[model samples]
Target: MDIDAWWGIIGQARAAVGDRADDRDSPDDPLPGALVDVLAVLEPADIIDFYVKHIEVTDAAERYPLMWASFLIEGSVSGDGFMDFRDGLALLGRETFSRAVADPDSLADLPVVVRMSRDEGGWIGFEALSLPITDAYRRVRGETDTLRAAVEAAIDGMTRPERPGGGTWDPEDDDAMRLHLPRLAALFLD
Candidate 1:
């Protein structure tokens, strides 16, 4: 699906959930429920397209600089940690996602980041954002993975790198981290 079409789904979910979309404190995520409600009305083809588009949109945010951003925020990038970080970024909505993808360092100035820095207990990974498609499929088709599996098999056919590559500085180098991510350094490192 096209980027606009994909974002349309996310927009609807965000709108439907209202404040729940950003409620990290809540143990229950109403976003996926809201997203499923939005998805249940769409044609079946569009649902498959939505899954592919979701992956593409999240992958597009997997830049090397953003990994360092993840490290700064989360203390380290564990297996699939960066993946989950990108999920959170996508959930932040189109403007924030676009800004962050274009300028990874700009994230330090965001209100959400500011809150995270202040609340050391806070983290920015929304793994649940990945749930709605499968949930919606099951909700619509009823207790069957066959359709979802076929769609995912087609998506998985195309290949990409395991992890994003290319960075001139090491995460261990405080000076370079500060120099490259000055604002984030002030927020998380300093």
Candidate 2:
């Protein structure tokens, strides 16, 4: 996607999250779901940085969202307490993030895909990473169309308006990943 497109998306996502927060019964309500939507469009490493900047959870289960985000980015869960690569993706594919999260465990298994790039020594790192959705996986048990529809529905589902008490919707939240576009473009030029 182009930078402008990403900016638009981030704005939408942030608005969605802020809106949800307003409706929350508690001030400290977990922001995982909406934040997940925002991170979904970003590279794994950037996702990690975002959480480090935003989350204050000291517990493992609470940290699952960040762990899962990292898993999606790096494709492996190496480190203290994280699942190995194959299992990590399987867990996410199976929608088991809420169940199999392990926090406080030192993450050991970094994705080989991410590890291989550390030698590049460039900020252009991971600009080419794309959200690798696949039809074959969606076809598991002949559910390709169903899965596609589900994904589309989820993306569409993010369009609800902000609740009365929700913070003002900032369009940048939905497409925060766009913040990296300049870096990505620079990578391309190199």
Candidate 3:
């Protein structure tokens, strides 16, 4: 992955989101609006390619604990739910979000993301976020199995009991997810 290129895209998206000159009425939710604006200017496919390449190059498992944590905190506080938050990240386009993941510390100034570092649920949120990515990665790679079935298979094979309740994080779960991310990257990215 071209790290510099990824940073450039992120810088552009942030600037666009922050721009006050565009007289357009800002949505009550700025993040989503910013994301839509960014998407309008960039190719989604290229962003996804950058994301897949990022996962391939970065030791995501070891590197992203904080990013996932922040997502959890942001989700809980915003009441956006993890899935919706992930979708928003998707809308921001992969490159932007990938930069967030690679350098979560940069997000610490954001009130919602700051809570993630302090809250217990951050890790859990991180784990929850991984599931859909894994499924999408598998599908993007043309895996014939259903996403549910694949998720079930992965969960079933786990040595520890699943994290109780819907939105909790488990270290073992994170480990399992880390192992799969590269495969996920390999599937759709050339």
Models ranked on lDDT = 1, 3, 2
Q: For residues 1-190, could you state the per-residue lDDT of candidate 1 as single tens digits?
A: 7899788888888998886675444577777688888887886667877877777788777678888888887778865888888887887789878988877788886666787888744456777455778778777778547656766786778565677755647877888889888899889878
Give candidate 2's TM-score.
Answer: 0.21
lDDT of 3 by residue, 1-190 (tens): 3766654554554566664312112334343344334433444344344444333323232233432443334433222344344334433444545655554433444333333345422211222323333433443544424444544554455454222122233423545334433222122121
Q: Choose the strongest candidate by TM-score.
A: 1
Model 1: residues with Cα > 4 Å off, grouped in runs:
23-25, 166-168
Arrange candidates by TM-score, highest first: which order?
1, 3, 2
Worst 10-residue lDDT window for candidate 1 reads 120-129
- Residues 1-190, candidate 2: write the lDDT tens digits: 4333433433454466664332122344333244345556655434333322221111223333444433333434433323233222221221232233332111223232223234322110111011212222222233335444544554454433222121222222323212322222122212
Q: Tell me which of candidates 1 and 3 scores higher on lDDT.
A: 1
The residue pairs that clash in candidate 3, if any, are 124-168, 124-169
Q: List candidate 3 stretches off by more than 4 Å.
A: 19-27, 43-45, 54-110, 113-190
Quality of model 1 by C-alpha lDDT: 0.76
